[model samples]
Every structure is written in structure tokens, then in C-alpha cells.
Target: MPTVALIDYGSGNLRSAAKAVERAAADAGLSMTVTVTADADVVRRADRVILPGVGAFADCGRGLSAVPGMLDALGEAVIRGGRPMLGICVGMQLMATIGREHGDHAGLGWIGGEVLKLTPADPALKIPHMGWNELEIVSDHPVLRNLPAGAHGYFVHSYHFVCANPAHTLARVEYGGPVTAAIGRDNLVGTQFHPEKSQETGLALITNFLTWNP
Candidate 1:
């Protein structure tokens, strides 16, 4: 069975993300071991990794750093080992070079970008972008494969990733102008929206991630 490490560093909707992955795997007729852990050893040993966060960028960053050896373990497992990785919401924000949410906070620098608060050109649009929005896929990335047309992703965030390299942006959604829906490269992929909450579209994304080789 493929082992999946669902990092629990005191900030994310960890259980929901775990259940979503488990359900997706079961529904796809694939068996996977999903371990919700803060243990560095477990993370280092897992075949895949999922990082989920649900708070301020700096807070989440601090929470993640608080776990001893967790940062280095993640680097070993995901970056050096080339294991598949998926970051969700603020978890995805951590992939950026820095986040300018409340203050300037350093991130993983895994992907070249910055997470900045959403500035909708239209005054009426909300800051959180708290509902479903259509995903405009710009690349034929494997994680985005087979998503139905007009596919909408569940979103609730004030900050959005502005990728330094456009090719790293796999999909985008329009909040007021354009917000990054998904960002990815190599074996790493991150979603600004919550797959655990996104109904069919979310499930499809999870399924794709489970089966994606790269």
C-alpha cells in the first residue's frame, strides 16, 4: 500500500484532508495508508505528502517550524526524494518565496512566487473569495487532467499566489481579475482551494493527485 503523510502541525483542517484523500482512494479502488502525523520519521518514510493549512501565513509557518525536524524531513522526502507533494490553501501559500499577508513572512521557497492579499479590481468582490469559482486551466498538467469543463473549485482565502514563472501556474480562477487556482512543477503541486470541500471537482483533484506519477 502506498503510504501518505498528512502533516499535522497544529494549523490545518488535517482530519478533513485525510478523510478526503482516504475517500478518494477508496472510491478509485486504490488502497492507501494515510497517516496523520507530526513525526519527522513518518514523514520521511511516506510515499506521498499532503500539507494543509487554515490560518495566517506567518502563523502556519511558525507552527510548521515548531515541529522538530519536520522542515528538514519535508525537504528530504518531497524535494530531495522527489515524492509527490500537495499543499492546500494556506499550506499552498507556504510554497511561495514569501507571503505578504499581515506582514512579510518567509515561506518554503519551493516555488518561485509571493502570496499577496487579493486585490479585486471591482470593489464589490469580497476579500475572501468565499465561494466556488470556475477554474480556467492554462496547462495540460497531469493533476488537472480530465476535469470537466466549467469546473469550479471551492475557495476561501484572502491571499493568492502570484507565480514568478507563469509555466508553474497550472490553473487560474477569476476572483476580480485572476487568482491562482493551482500551482505545480515536477512532483510538487499545490491548490489555493480546498479539495476536501469542493464536491465533485475536489474529489477529482484528489484522485488525480493519488494516481499522478509526477
Candidate 2:
């Protein structure tokens, strides 16, 4: 049985995310433990880690940093440890090198990118782009299985990740401008929107990640 650690930093909708993970695991017919903590050894020993966050990117980054050794634990698990890891919402943005929201700030740099505000080259589009949007899966990754090319998922964010390397981008959503919906490199996977807050397609995505062999 693989244990999935949901890092309980001070941010993120932890309860909702935990329930989503539990439900996803059950739907996949896989038994797993889902808990919130920042214990380094527990994170390293787990089969997977979920870095969930919400609110401002800078505050979220600071919260993660507040936890002693949390980043190093994640590094070990996702890099040297080879345990699968996922980042949700602002958590996903944290994986990038820089975020320009509320002021410029540093990120995890796991992926090369800058998190910038959703632009409106067209005045008709809304800021803080919210509600369900269509996802265009650009690759054949198993984590996206059963999801149509135009699957709709919930989104609520003002800033979006501009991936420096297009190869790392796995999915995209249009909000006046094309924004990265998800990005992945090896064992590290991230989503700019909250799959937990999304409905069926969101559930499917989480389930696939839990059961994914790669």
C-alpha cells in the first residue's frame, strides 16, 4: 500500500484536498493513507507527496519555507527519492522559478517559468478567471486518461504559469490568453487549477495520478 502525504503547510484547502484524494483512491480501487503533515522522514518514506496551496503565491511560498526541511524533503522524494509528487493551484505555481503576483517573488524552480497575471489583450475577458474551463491535453500521458481533449474543469486564478520549456507543458486552457493548465517533468506533476474543486474530470485526474505507474 502506497502512502500519499499531503504536506500541511499553513495554506491550501487541506480538508477538501484530503477528501478528494481519499475519494480518488477509493474510485481507483486502491487503498492508501492520506494525511497532512510536514515531517521530513514521513514525506521521504511515503509513496507520493501532494503539495497543495491556495491564496497569494508569495504567501504560499513563505508558508512552505516556514516549515523547516519541507523543501528538502520534497526534493528527496521527487528527485533523489523517486516518489511521485503533485502540486495544486498556487502550489503548482510555486514549482516555477519566479512569480510576479503582488510583487516579484522566488519559487521552487523545479520548472523554469514565471507566474504572471492573466492578461487581457482583449477587454471582453474577465480577470481572476474563474469557473469551469476546457482543458486541451497536449500529450498521451496516462494521468490524463479518459479525459477528452476538451474536458471542462473548474479554475479560479488571476495568475498563470508561463512555462519556459514548452516540453514540460502537458495541458493548457484558454482564458483570453492561453495559460498552462498543467505541467510535468518526470515524477513532478503540477496543475494551476484545483482538481479537488473540479468535479468528475478532476476526480479522474487525481485517481490517475494515484494509480499511475510512471
Candidate 3:
């Protein structure tokens, strides 16, 4: 069975995310171990990794970096090791090159992008784009497989990822204008919305992530 390390670095919806991944594996009849861990050694050896975050970009970034060797382990395991990784919400934002949340903050630089504040064309729209938003599939990626048309993704965040390379964006949601719903590059995939909160659409994504070869 593949061991999936759900990194616990004082951030993210750790338990719920782990449970969701477990449920997805079970539903797909796939045997996978989803362990919530803070140990870098465990992460380095993990077959797969799930990073779930819920906070400001700078705070999440600092929290992740605070864990000794955790950052290196992630780079070793995901970048060099080429293990598949899924970053959720603020977790997804961390993958960007930089985050302009409060000020300019450094990111993992896994994906070529920047985390910017959400700017809906309509001023009446709320700042934190909370609630379910229909995803507009942009690119063909394994992480988005078997998703139905007009599938809605659950989101609750004030900031959104702005991809430097447009091809990195997998799917987008319309909130007055286009908001990035999902991002993918090589073995890394991330979602701005909480897949655990999403029903069928979320389940399908987690299942695909567990079984995704790339």
C-alpha cells in the first residue's frame, strides 16, 4: 500500500484532509495509508504527500518553514524524488514563486506563479469568495479526471493564485471574472477550494490524486 504523508506543520485542516483522502482511497477500492505527520524523515520516505492549509499566505509560509527540515524534506521528496503532491487552499498558494498577501513573501517556487488578492469585476462581490463555485476546466490534467461538466468546487479565501505560465492553470471559476480553481505542473497539483468540503466533485479529485501516476 502507498503511504501518503499529510504534513502537519501547525497549519491546514489536517485531520479532515487525511480522512477525506482515506475515504477517497476506500471508495476507489485502493489501499493507501494516509498519515498526518510533522516528521521530515517520514515525509522524505512518503510515497505521496498532501498539504492542506487555511490561513494567510505569510503565516502558512512561516509555519511550514518553522518545522525543522520539513522544507528540505519536501524538496527532497517531491522535487527530487518526484512524488506526487497535493496542496490545498493556502497550501496551494505556498507552491507559487511569491505571495503578495500582506507584503511580498517567498513561496516553495514549485509552480511559476504569485498569490494575489481576489479582484472580482463586480464590486458587490464579497472579498473572501466563500461558497461553492463552478469550475471551468482549462487544461487536460490527470488530477481533474472523471469530473462532470460545470462541477462546483468549494472555496473560502480572499486571495487567488495567478499563474505566470497560463498553461499551469488547470481549471478556473468565474466570480465576475476568472478565478483560478486548480493548478498542476508535472507531479504537483493544487486546489484553491477545499476538496474535503466538496461532495462528489471533491471525492473524484482525491480519488484521482491517489491513483495519479504523474
Candidate 4:
């Protein structure tokens, strides 16, 4: 059975995410072990990794960094080992080169980019870009398998990732304009929305991530 490590970095709803991934694995007929862990050793040994966060980028980044050897473990497991990894919401934002929320904070820099405030063209558009929004598929990826363009997912964030390489963008959403919904490079992929809260579309995405080979 594959082991999926849901990193507990004191940010997001870890239980909800664990339950969602558990359901996703079961529904996908995958024999997987899901563990919500803060221990670096457990994360280092897991076959798959998930980083989920729900708050400000700086706070989440700090939370992740606070873990004694968590960052180093992830670097060894995902970056050096090339294991498949996923990030959700603020977790995804933390993958950027830097995040400009609450101040300029350094990120994991797995994917070269910066997280900036969403600038919706329409003044009437909201800042957080909350609620369900349609996804426009920008690139073909295994994690997006069977998910067609315009699929809706739940979102709640004030900032979005601006990929330094346009080719790294996997999906986009039209808020007041084209807002990045997902980004991917090699074995790392991230979604700005909350897959656990996103109904069927979210489940499908989670399922895809679990079974994705690369």
C-alpha cells in the first residue's frame, strides 16, 4: 500500500483534509495509508506528500518553518527524491519563490513564482475570490486526468500564484480576469482551492492526485 503523508504544520484543518484524502483513496480503489503527521521521519518515508494550509501566507509559511526538521525532510523527500507532492490553498502559495502577504516572506521555492494579491479587473469583484469557480485547464497533467475544462472547485483566497514560467500553469479561473487556479512542475502540483470542500470536482481531483504516477 502507498503511504500518503498529510503534513500537520498547524495551519489548515488537518482532520478534514485527512478524511477527504482517505475517502478519495478508498473511492479510487487504492490501497493507501493516510497519516496526518508533523514528524519529519514519517514524512520522509511516505510515498506521497500533501501540504494543506488555510490562513495567511506568512503565518502558514512560519508554521511550516517552525517544525524542527519538517522543511529539510520535505526537501529530501520531494525535491531530491522526486516523489509526487500536492499543495492546497495557502499551502500552494507557500510553494512560490516568495509571498507578498502581510510582508514579503520567503516560500519553499519548489516552483519559481510569487504569490500576489488578486487584482480583479472589475472593481465590484471580491478580494478573496471566495466560493465555487470554474477552472479553465491550461495544460494536460495526470493529476487533472478525466477533469475537463470549466470544472468548478471551491476557492477562498486573497492572493494567487503568479508563475515565473507560464508553462508551469496547469489551470486558470476567471475572477475579474484570468486568475491562476493550479500550477505544476515535474512531480509537484498545487491547487489554490480547497479540494476537501469542493464536492465532486474536488473529489475527482484528489483521486487523481492519489493515483498519479508523476
User: TM-score, each model?
Assistant: 0.98, 0.96, 0.98, 0.97
The TM-score that candidate 3 achieves is 0.98
lDDT of 2 by residue, 187-208 (tens): 8899887889888888989998
TM accuracy, model 1: 0.98
Clashes of each: 0, 0, 0, 0
The pairs that clash in candidate 3 are none
Worst 10 residues of 4 by lDDT: 142-151
TM-score winner between candidates 1 and 2? 1
1-214 per-residue lDDT for model 4 (tens digits)? 7899999989988998899999988988899999999999999999999999999999998899999899999999999999999999998999999999988999999999999999998999988788999888889888887874568989999999999999999999899989999999999999998889887888899999998888
Query: In candidate 2, which residue pairs clash?
Result: none
| lDDT digits (tens) for residues 132-188 of candidate 3 | 999988898989978866689999999999999999999999997999999999999
- For lDDT, candidate 2 versus 3, the one ahead is 3
Q: How close is candidate 2 to the true structure, as a TM-score?
A: 0.96
